[model samples]
Structure formats: structure tokens, C-alpha cells
Target: MTLRKPPIPRLLLNNVSCMRNAQQILRHVNVSVHDGGALVLKGTNGSGKTTFLRMLAGFTRPSAGEILWNGHNITESGVFHQYKLHLNWLSLKDAIKEKFTVLDNVQWFEILEGKQGKSMAAIELMGLGRLAKEKARMLSMGQRKRLQLARLLAIDRPIWLLDEPSVALDDEGVKLLEYIIKEHRKKGGIVIVATHLPIEMEDPMVVRLPPRFPRRMTLVDMLDRSGLD
Candidate 1:
């Protein structure tokens, strides 16, 4: 399929300000991501990477600011088809259906999304070929991570929002993720990852959120758990 112009500045945040529990989280932050660009969010926990991502995904409302997509404000549609058309997301939990087999889960996703392809090929690409028939509940943590990665390849979205994609991944899984990211960038896809892991990418932009006062343990430990230490 021929790709569109990518709508320069695929995602734009204008004077974004967010707060939680009466505490200001983000302060008039403005950022833009162009086609084929990469943006990495790095901060100790409570830095609001997840909250920022949620706002981008339209799951949470920002206290102030506008989110624009392809020159249009996203507040109207509330992150629907127009936004989903070119977006895909992956978090650390691996959220693969535990009751389904690897191949079955992939097949189900394809069916639900009205997308189809060579399932075995996709699994093999993620090095999960041998576990194709294994149920998600039966797979190892690393294997589950591969399953999540496989979703990226199968869906082929232009914009990827990944929250800690490397969690639970082994050495080989990390290598596979690197390869996948490289290929995605080559294909003109945009990636926004909220992680502190040392990823192998080409000059990816990094955004570090300010530290929250009171030295919250939950706020500091999540970033450390991201494996960048």
C-alpha cells in the first residue's frame, strides 16, 4: 500500500498542562513528532510518562492544552478511528489473552481488526515459531514479550506508542526489538516510547519530565525498574 504524506507533525501537543490529585504533573509542555521520528520519554517514576501517554491516547483529559493530529485538534473525535487508523500501542504487561494460543491470539487480533497475514511468518519473525501453538498462559515471560512484539509486526501501524516494550525480554528478545524498531523507522513510522532502557536507535529524541517533590518511592523506582541503570 502506498503511504500518505504522513501529515507532517503526526502528533502535536500545544501548551499541554496536566494535573493529578490537585498536583501539577505537566506544565504547558509543547512537543511535536514528525514522520519517521522517534521520541523517548525518560524520567524517574512519577515523571508522568504513563499519564502523558494516556493523554496522547485520549484516555485522560489534560487540565489544559490541545492535542493535534495531522493539523486537526484531537479533542473533537476523542481519539477514535482517525487517530486509530495510524496508531498502535504496546505496554509491558503483554496483555495477550491467556486463554488463547499464540497463533490463535494473533488470529483473533487479525479478525477483530479485519487484518490478515501469514501468522506463522509473523511469529517466526519474533522468534516465537516453536511456541506458536502454546497458550499465552503457558508461555514464559520472555515468550509473552515476543507475542506482544508480534502484534506490532502484524498490525503495521504508522504510529507506535510503546510503554516499556523491553520489559521481561531476554537478550535475544531485546535484539529482536531493536531490529523491529529499525525496520519500523525505515518504513516511515513514528515511535513514542516511555522507557529508560538503553535502546539501540538512531538519535532518538529524549524528553525528561521533572522530579516530583516529597521523594516518592513509587515515583523513583519505576524508572529504575526500566533496566536503564
Candidate 2:
């Protein structure tokens, strides 16, 4: 019998580098997210986790290296929209239109994604059925977080890039995030998350980023040097 090789990763970053205000934010980072696996990014605040996510989302271009998907380099691919279609990103702010009701916000997102009927489904999944009609600005912090998560359920994607998903959440909200992540993994989806604390996960590969750097180096190079490769 032929030994099977793992399929190509769904996402890849090779030797990526970035800088802001003359300060290097990231250096020569290389990461791969295979289908059905999770990569946890551990770092302190301002450690470039969000910036890295933005680069992956095509919001910013890397100063060096390439961002690839299944061996196709999206750098200069000039089709960021296509890449965004497959990526589901939840940011720290959990931005919700203050003027729109909870139901309206979810509904608008569904319409935007062209996923009709998902608004109600998402609201129910997030256990927000009771508060769907409440204004977004009126909802408590936990409620807002739930609403943000509802959007994730509504827009199912292969890749989930979550930034500090548990911020300002009660125990219930944390459990909801945990449940969603486990379910997504069970469905063979990929997850990359940046968090300050260790999350309860079943044997996920962990990568911790230092808050300060002695010299400029790529993440891949650092990993290789640290025997983490």
C-alpha cells in the first residue's frame, strides 16, 4: 500500500515580513494551516497578531514573502475578494452597527452574504432569539459578543481567524465559542486564533510570539532556530 501524504494546507504564509512606522511588526513568518487542524497564536498585546490576520485577509500587503492558498500565491493575484469569500474573521471590537437592531444586523449580514434565512438561524444558534429585536447598541457586552458569533455560524467558511474571541464574555459566551470551534474542527475546518491565555484545546499545535525582539528575523526562522519547526 502506498503511504498517503497529507493534502496541501488550506492556507500558507511563506517568509512574510511587515513593518509599521519604521518599526518591524513581523519578520519572515511562515505558517501553514491544514484542513481540520488548529494553530494557536500566543502573544501579548501589540505583538502583531491582528496585523498578521489583516495580511491574511488581504487588508495589508506583506513587505516581503508570499501568501499562498493551496500552492497558488495570492500576492499580486489581485483577487482579494475571492480570498475573502473563504475566510471568516472575527475581530476584537466585534463591530456591530449601533443603529440596527440585533435582528436587523444579522439580517443585513445574511443579505450581504447572500445567505437567506440564516439571520434567524444564526440568532437561534447564538441563543439570542429572545433579544433579536433589541438594538445592537442596547445589548450588553456579552450579548454583543453573542451577536458577533451568530454571524460566524451564519457564514460558514473553511477558515476561521479569531482575535481574542473570549473578550468581555461570561462563562456562557466562552462555552459558546468553545463549542463553535470544536464543531468547526469536527467539520474539518481550519482555525487560527490569537489569544493571551492558553485555551482549552485537545492537542493543538501552539506558537508563542515574544513581545520584544533582539534582532530582525522571520517567524519561520525563529521557529527553526528554537527547534519548533
Candidate 3:
């Protein structure tokens, strides 16, 4: 009898493009990542960073192109839902209930996902154990961001999709986020982050989106505005 190695996880985007209301957001974007890898998305405002991330999360459909997971097309209806089970998407919104306490929010997530006793460990890891009982409404912006990030630890998903994850995080909070990402990658997990803040990662693959075209101006108008004398 011979032992075999486990298959490596992979994600690929083939000439992906997205359109919203007839306006192209992303154009012919392509990227690929394997397990234990990280991909960072860099783009200017309106350059479709969020839109592309949403498409990867299956929350939005791409106007063109295909998203593949482990060599399988994820855009297919049945495949998408199944693939989503292994993904964790943290959007710009905090997604915490104002009325719930810090620990309560995480506990609720665990309960809803049928995961018991998995909340406290994650809360503590995110440095929220001290504020466990504090209502989310009372926590500071940085604290709230940490609370939101704790979900990643609690959920145990292999793929993490974060948009502007460091929005309100302070220096320490940013460090915590980095630590979490590093550990996740070490465990053969995949991470994709859309951020403007600097993140410390080892050999991260970058996808830079070009700036969107100015809709209100024509070629002649752009030249006239160039101030060439």
C-alpha cells in the first residue's frame, strides 16, 4: 500500500469582468492562488475592488469570465452554494448587532452555525476577552473591528475574503489582524484582502486594477484639461 499527498486547494479567475448598470467595473481581470497563499487587491476608488471581491464571494455575478475553485467552475448554481460553505466574507460593514454584547455576537454566530463553545476562544484571540460583556454599541471603532474579525477564528473557514479590513484598526489591532492571517495561511488556508493599509505578508500576490475611465470627459476634453503649454 502507498500513501498519497492531499490535494492542494486552488482558486482561479479567468478573464473576469464585472458590469454594473451598463458601466464596466472590472475589465478582463485574471489571477490565481493555491492553498497557503495570499492575494492582495490594490486599486483606486471606483476601480472595482469591492465589486471583484463580491463576485468572488458569489454575492454578485460577473458580467463576463469564470471563477474556478479547485479546478471546478464556481459560477454554476449548485457549485456556488457548496463552495460558499468553505468561505468567509467580511465586508466593509461590521455586521455586528448593536444591541448584543461583544461575546454575544460571536456566540450567536457559533450557535447559528451549529458550532458550540467556539466563541470564547476566538474572542480571546482577537483581544476582546476583556470586553466580552460590553455591548457592541458601546465599543470603540477599533474594538468593533476586532470583534468583527473574531468571526474568522470562530467559523473555521478555509477561504477568507476581506474588504478594507483595517478601516478603523489602530496599530495594535492591525498587528492582531496580521497575526490571524499569518496563522490561517500557515494552516493551508487562502486569504484575499482589499486594503489600502500596509500589511506584512510573505510574498503576497498582487492584483492591481487600473483606474476607471472618466465618464464625463471625451478624449479631446481630456487633452484640453492636460494643461500642456
Candidate 4:
């Protein structure tokens, strides 16, 4: 049986703004991405890079704008659940379950995502084949990062939202990451990465978040967090 590919995906951010502690961290940000596209988000700490990625993931709502996926408003309650089905989110934390073995962790993710026969291949691709049975707690920081990438590959999602994905990686590991990302884009995957380190990918678009921000916390910020806003 032949498998059918889904329609090409697109993500759009229009007139987006974000505030925390009552100060604006991002102002009127606008960007768009289509299938096979890569976007590298650059900004200093507190520059709202995390916020922007979270907004795209439907975890954080924009202060004033729309985040659209395939021309549908992703921020809407009815659409968020469906929107995330296509996403693979890698946040600051590696999301590794320390009690599980390397293989177990990867396999668990594949199970959750309803994929099969892919975990071992992804483990080898991330250079963790030799350590596949080792407990997660025993892996070095770099190896743990690689394991996260392996999980990423195993699930085979089309949209990737990575935050500081290259951190703690050595030179060789970085190269492997670049290779994975480059190939993912070739297959029409959409990636948006937030990082302080440089990532070399295939013709990726660079988005520099606004640096100016109010350092003071505001009532709106407190309200948002407390679910009162």
C-alpha cells in the first residue's frame, strides 16, 4: 500500500508581542515558515526566544497577534490539540527519564507517538548504539543530548521546536546534529530553534529577537501566570 503525504505545513506569526513582569520582551514580531524551512531564533537571555517558541507550540498565547498553522489560528482552544500532533518540542530540559535505560527512553517515546521499528535506527544515527542499554542516569551530558535527538528521530514528527539543542554537545556531536537537521529539512520538516550558540543548517532563515525589554515586572505578568488575566 502506498502512503499519502500530508499537505505542506506553514507557521505564521503576525504582529506578535510578549510581556513579562509588566515589561515588553518582544514587540510586533512577524515571521512565516513553510515546509522544508528552518528558522534560527537568536537573542540574549530574557529576550523572549523561549516565549516565542512556546507561542508557536500553543503553550503560550501571544500578547496581541495570531499564530497560524496552515492558515488556521493555532491559539484558538479548538485547534491547539490538533496543531501539536505534528510537533516535536525540545525544551531547555532534555526530558530524559533518568530511571530508564537509553533504549527504553527512546522506545517509550516511539510508543507514545505510535511509531514502530524506528528507535534502534535513530539510536544508531545519534551514535548511541553502543550504549543503548545503559541507564539514562549514567550517560554524560552530551550523550543525554544525543539521546534526546534520537527520540526526536524515532518519533518522526514534521514540526520541530528546539531550544538550545546544541548546548553541551562536543564538536563531533554538533556535526551530527547539523547533519540530522539538514536532512530533516530536505524531507519538508519545519524547524524553529532558539539558541545562543550557532547552528549550521541548510539555508536557514535567521530571526533576531528584539533586545530591548522592560526589566520591571508588571501586574499583567503576574495576572497571566496566576490565570487571572
Clashing pairs in 3: none
Better of 2 and 3 by TM-score: 3
TM-score of each: 0.86, 0.85, 0.88, 0.87
lDDT of 4 by residue, 15-72 (tens): 8887765768677878888899999999987787888788788887788888888888
Per-residue lDDT of 1-229 in model 2, one digit per residue for the tens? 9999988887788998887656688788888877888888788887777877777878888889988887777665555657778889899777699989998887887788877777787898788999888888889888888898898888788889888888877887788788888989999988888888656766677766667554568898889999984
Question: What overall lDDT goes with each candidate model?
Answer: 0.83, 0.82, 0.88, 0.88
Between candidates 2 and 4, name the one with more favorable TM-score: 4
Question: In model 2, which runs have C-alpha deviations exceeding 4 angstroms?
Answer: 1-5, 213-229
Runs of candidate 4 with Cα error greater than 4 angstroms are 1-9, 212-229
Q: Return the clash pairs for model 1, or none.
A: none
User: Order the candidates by TM-score, highest first — what do you get?
Assistant: 3, 4, 1, 2
The residue pairs in collision within model 4 are 21-217, 21-218, 22-218
Summarize candidate 3's per-residue lDDT along 92-134 as a digit string, tens digits.
7878999999988988888877887878989998899999998
Candidate scoring better on TM-score of 1 and 3? 3
RMSD to truth, every model: 7.1, 8.6, 3.8, 8.4
Candidate 3 local lDDT, residue 51: 85
Estimate, for each residue in 109-187, the C-alpha lDDT of model 1 and write its tens digit: 6676788885677899999899898878999888888888887788778989899888788888899998899889888
Worst 10 residues of 1 by lDDT: 211-220
**After best superposition, candidate 2 residue 26: deviation in angstroms?**
2.6
lDDT of 2 at 38: 89
